[model samples]
Target: MRIPSTRTVPTRSRTAVVDSVWSDAKEFLTQFAQESRGATDTDRRLREVRSAIEATGTYRHTTEELTFGARLAWRNAERCIGRLYWNSMTVRDLRHLHTADDIAEQCVEHLRTATNGGRVRPLITVFAPDRPGRPTARLLNEQLVRYADDPRSRQRTHLAQGLGWTRGDKDFDVLPLLTRTGRDDTPRFHELPSDAVLQVPLTHPQYPAFASLGLRWYAVPAICDMALRVGGVTYPTAPFNGWYMGTEIGARNLADTQRYNLLPTVAQLLGLDTSSDRTLWKDRALVELNLAVLHSYQQAGVTITDHHTESARFLTHIEREEQHGRTVAADWSWIVPPISASATPVFHRYYDPPNPHPHTAFVHHASAADTH
Candidate 1:
């Protein structure tokens, strides 16, 4: 899954509920109820959902349907390469929550449960959806734990300033949760407690001095802003996460030129000749950086997957899905590891095109902030 950038895109209109949504909802309810319970009361259940939607421009999903939908969304995530564990995900229904404080508290709870004492589990918290006249609260952070760079710092990223983050001694000072009360509401920032967050300071087994770099990351990668759509209803405040593949942190978050951009800094520390791109100094530093990320997370007793191991496991997942007679849809650009693409098993194959309508899906919701 693509991590949301801090930059806000311009808003258009609230997404219209899917066309033929009622029919689709009925089909899903009928099929799922029949398969799971051998029930043929789909016509009745379909009327139930239809009545609710026609009355309120929305419908409610039963606990069974909600759980199944959440899992299906993970299965349908086209950009994600970790669909192997989609069935094992834990879904928390927080559709009752609407206030900013309530939403913030549940978000904290999600982090605690997903962190799972460093044995990270795939989890999602589904918050209330935006109704015809009532817009649910929204979180502004791309991930639950992201840093704020000083506006004056040369390394500041595109969307750094004006989120009410204070400058610190280091570039990576953790930012508070920024949320909006309603669709038209101004954002409010809340400071998260230290205990609620579990962070692993980066250190290298080979380069003992790497600890001095003051790099650290949160245990959970909880994404709090994406919309979770299931059976024609859209929950705008749903937050979810799976455990990290180390390259996501080392290669993209920390090393991307648009992000922390730490390759030059690390290369300087490693005494690499940065005078020429011909020397492959960046490539060398990247390897060491990833090494530090893996080593640090492991020593800290956190769950993290290495690219080589994860690549092989992805293939195993593909085989298993095929055996079950399910198509394995994938995006090749995302399936291959950021580093050493040719070395992995996922590099040589073409994936089936994504199915347009999966039982569940993560849909991007244009933020109210973007409208102004």
Candidate 2:
């Protein structure tokens, strides 16, 4: 019943390659003169970075390794620069050489070349004002102009965007307020961009599938469990039961339980009688089941945060359970059966330690004859 401990050697080689590519890109960017158009610099740098990255075998290995999230992160960073270049060109001073259409065309051409003659198109959508007073396109244009003229505009733009203030107006503040209050007021500026949406077809569809499966089945639950334990006490405004239901919370809970070997107090909190019979059992059972599943994950080493300590603890728990004469069910076996190659079963130990002893040995033996 002692579960074997396994070690996973962390792979830093891939990360090292990515760092090398980044260094090469920084060197390439330094060659560009300050007087040159920003768009031109961005375009040249993106192409150079991509080329350098591909040359280093990072991109190829990631693709082969099916590290879709990493690949997507790289692609998105390049795309963001490309989009920024276009936006800068459109709002550039007349003294600057390139036209908006010219810059846009250059972007499309670069994408096609990078993708090796793949179909690439830019789509544009419009953003309208929201109720309780929203900003107009004119106001947004003014803000864009202000941003274009200012030297510190890039930082400001990032801040504004992060705050959901894409278009400068009263609605920018309004949207954040509404979001904080959990009120969905169909705020303005939520619409798609005015220009075309750039569509990039992925090379392999199954790559995404693998990335999604890992996050949902493993990463997410662990993250949820951790976040809840660390931040739960302070944020008691909402019912802990409702909070636990969220994916983020669930993930944090799994992580915390695996790491600390402790179940969330929220489960016990939820188990308390809340006047209504329907509400009490439903809430309690949900929390307890989540805790049970997390325990199962820990025992199987599927979500163990620290292998050195946790693995030992898990094996000890398994051994104790076995000593108590518990049987492993098919659903709770940690080892994969030959019959079902794909199924990942949970490891669980069932035992009752507090039962009283049944027999009085002295009375049953010679002590009874002596008394007679």
lDDT of 2 by residue, 283-338 (tens): 44334434443443343333212222332343454455368563212222222211
lDDT of 1 by residue, 1-372 (tens): 998799653333112443356756876686567546544577787777878766665678877788888888888787888888988999998888877899888888888899999999899998887765667788876677676662323222223335454544466676677778665676776777778789999999888788888888878888765788887777888889999999999998889887788999999889999999999999999999999999989999999999999899889988997897877888899999999899999998899988777656887767722323
Worst 10 residues of 2 by lDDT: 222-231
> At residue 93, what lDDT does model 2 achieve?
14
lDDT of 1: 0.79
lDDT of each: 0.79, 0.26
- Give TM per candidate: 0.88, 0.17
Worst 10 residues of 1 by lDDT: 150-159
Q: What is the lDDT of residue 181 in candidate 2?
A: 13
